[model samples]
Target: MRGRFSQAWSDVLRGSAFPHEGQAFLEQVFSADVFRPRPDHGGREERFALTYERLRHINDRVREAGSTVPLVQDRERLFPLLAWSAVADPALFYAMFLHHCMTTGAVLEFGAGREDLADVLEELAATERVGALLMTELGHGNSNASVRTVAEYDADREEFVLRTPEPAAVKFPPAVAAEGVPRLAVVLAQLVVDGAECGEFCFLVPLRDADGPLPGVGVRPLQPSPWLPLDGAVVSFDGVRIPYRFWLRDNAVLTADGGFTDPFGSPAIRARRTLSLIRFAWEAAVVGLAATAGASAAVAVRHAHRRRTGGRFAAGRPVIRYRNQQRALFGALSGAYVARLVAAATAGPEAPALTPRSVRTTFLMKVVTDRIAERVSARARTASGALGFLAANRFLDYQGFAHSLNAAAADNQMLLLDGAQALLAGTAYTPPADEAPAAGDRDLLDPATWETLAAVRERILHQELADGLRKATGSGLAPFDAWNGLYDLAERLAETHAARLVLGTVREAVREVAGSDPVTGPEAAGILRDLLALHALEELAGHDGWYLAEGLLDADEVRGIPALLDRLCERLEPYAEELAEALGVPYPLVGAPIAGEDYVGGLAGTAPSSGTA
Candidate 1:
């Protein structure tokens, strides 16, 4: 079994067409041994301290090797690195996120060589100064426009006085917690000048000197959790003052005469522009969740291939050969693959700027990817049985991380509701007519068939929602009441739109792989085609009710989906290990001791001496 798995792994590595630089970087990361977790010290505080210490060491190694330069400077390498580091460790991944995504982006976008900030951008890039983004408040969450934290202009001193009026105004979870004092923070506060509300803007506040928190600033660490090992804190400000120039005034400015001016006519527009920094966090969440899901799938497949159990046909056979086990593990593998493609396409460089459409796309991507991660991790854990329940296996850790990803930067349900609103407003997506395939094709294996199915479903759902909303409002229902009546339809429409986007992305990826390399193109395409079909069938099966109610498909077609999925899974069984390997999670990062080669033999050696007793 080990020999066969190794051969399949080799085939996958040789068959897939990864970018040259990404492949080389992945090789370096695996060879460098920088991502190993520290041994447990049997206490929460001790474990947290050890995890953070390891995180700093990993950061130093990453910096020394310049592994993150590509991520900061080039868009092409960002997704690959994001995918790889996410499988390493959550604490380390968050640290890298602070350094590359939060700190570097904040400095480059807002603080480059500004005299008021004392060239903080250069310091941030060189790691001489560390930074955090303090945007979400305990009371307001990410509703920046309504946050209680205030930055009032002091006209006499030409400074901004920052204050947290209530306990709810405190910022919690500022990325790099418990590591040390952060030198700077991009604070989101309601800007007030002369008792008039100007708007919400980010002010660069100095949080700490070499010794401790700056005067008037307070930082208290939250209780430790083994699930997410960051030093999360509640940070408050009491009349903390900084020069007016420290305000990130790209969208609005404070005049010397104590007047506020913004090129954008409305304060709402300015606030929207100011909040574009959330895109980076969204991308991080998407990529990290996808990577975690992929890693979980890898571990599950490895365990399934090694562990044997009694079944109807045999006394002892590999668990992976069972139909139920194959469906669970392969289904997870497919979801992970789809998630990776979605993350890459949504956050890729060519994606539009931070417009409403792009924002909606990012939100949809987050919701879809996070849901996929949750489902995949759960399925993978169950497939691994007893071994999966152990913390040392890391599946449980992945599951927690997946749940946290859904709730982290933004809540998944809220994001789905926001997408629903977009649909109601007719600002949501509509597939181009030319791209839709001809109808009545039962070949679920064809990419065009799946594309057409997704597009048609989205169109039908959107029209249904539009009609229902119009009638409810026309009948004198209140605006909120009308929306409430159609809330379920609206949510379904958003999900359909996301499914269409995922199918389109998967089709494009299959084409890219098939066209890129002559030696491995056909082999890779075959595997991806099977995975794609499984993904489409599974989605269709879940939405069978919608299809039947809309007359999109006859009952026969709906009933045949299970059989089709089974066939596809059977065809994919031989290549399950290969497909998991193609996801690029390093073997060492699969932390389950049972997932290793000699688990059975090792357990035998450690068994108790029963005869003497």
Candidate 2:
């Protein structure tokens, strides 16, 4: 099994064109059942679904090409600007959930014990097969608001009988991954005990393991398209008994005695824990989008700068030089780094329990990530002009997948509202008047740590202020520049949050390490402080005039920000490669093809493109 990403990446850089099967398959993927209001040709639905199918197909090809890097790591190549189209057009998003279920390998991980599916998934994982998580039924998506599929505990038989009682309850629209005869899927259903609903959990079901379907696991395509294969449809369960351990066990668990035990402390804690896994995985995907777009911008801008303009239908010399193009590519460039910087700041392995404010802060970074991918990718297509539309070059397809991924990954507004609810929710959960630390508890508060947390709050407030001012001021600055300013502010706020978490976590790690040098620790601490100050200052500079006029800071502080920001950018710039290294695979989630060793030639003699062409 190819485990290393750098080697796996070489499979990413091959020709960006769709496969012949893929082109023939597209009409089925882009069908009316899938596209809805969007057109089948050249429209938003066509572009968005095409992008997802192509990128997913690329991952398949790359896996076949023997790239060790995970498909998630090579996201920059798979999901591009088309993600923007997904948010605007419903059709793109419609296929997104199904795409994720297929591409992500959900079924194989959770539904492993069902003999046929398990064998198929093991082979796929060993050989780089695309996988999907199939928990969301036609009856429910995020909310298990109501589920009807039953997996009855059969103690005597030593197996659970999985059954779908009604058509509405069946797993409808399992989508394209199922269309090509998939490798694996995690099927979600409720556990029944004498007609009472115990809870919901995922059962890993392998569809097309190494050979074919597991017995009793029926599979079929839903909507067909002219452009891509999006056969997300339904499947049924007729007393299909899977082994007990096939449950994901992330939240609710089945006891040996047949009772259910949720050991994550409380029902609320358990719920949050489950959501945490989902949020973390999806957030990782969001970050992947940023990394992908940033890498694409680096290459496209460099290429644009080199290419001469003014041929028939040509975008003039050096597209990035155009303010509008700069607005798109450079704006995204800043955003990806900013989001990365923020994620690093807010989330350390041992960070404090999220204050309501902290949860909102982290979740918001995810929102910005999703939104920025959508916004910038669309702009990238427009910036590329006709070239952006060509399936061979594949900017359009890349953009489409990004669009759908962002749109369906989770609704941004819903998530933002949820985060806000969680943040403000603390008041209801804890008595507001007694929330502050008690006397003598002051010693428990690490001074710098508290200051960092407080600073995070203040910094976010400042960004909110900046965004509001930008729209209110209507300064007529270019939209890209305006957004860049807003993102810089958001970026720093993100970093401030990340820095606090990392530093706060270091204290715990140091205590565990025992003899670690104190001097080195503080120096490292300084590095984190520098990170917060740097990105935050970049944000502050964008609206320095507003700050000065508003009396938020004196002229010296106002004037000093640019110098301070430049200083920080330069300092961090030197450490950028190290930063990338420190981030590990988490940083590569954005899906750009180039980040892996495959594109840059870590191993001699392998082709660099995504392998399928």
Q: What is the TM-score of each candidate against the true structure?
A: 0.89, 0.53
| Model 2 global lDDT (CA atoms, 0 to 1) | 0.45
Cα distance off (Å), candidate 1, residue 589: 2.9
What's the CA error at residue 117 for candidate 2, in Å?
12
Write the residue-wise lDDT of candidate 2 on 1-613 in tens digits: 1222212111111112212233223333333233232223464335534544543543344455565543323333223212322322323333332334233434433333445455544444443343454544566654544667787887666567888787667775555333233355566677675555666666655555444456776665455443333445567767677776665555466656676666654544543433343443453444345444444444343334433456465556544344445444444444444444433333332333545555555566666655555555565556656654544333454465455454344555556445433322243232112122333342212434333433445455544645554684497777556545544444444444433443443333223222234444454434434444443344446556754565544677666655555554545443333322322221122222333334323213365533111
Worst 10 residues of 1 by lDDT: 8-17
Give residue 459's lDDT in candidate 2 (0 to 100). 50
Candidate 1 structure lDDT: 0.72
lDDT at residue 330 of model 1 (Cα atoms): 93
Off by over 4 Å in 2: 1-124, 127-130, 166-168, 172-182, 208-220, 224-231, 250-276, 307-325, 339-363, 427-613
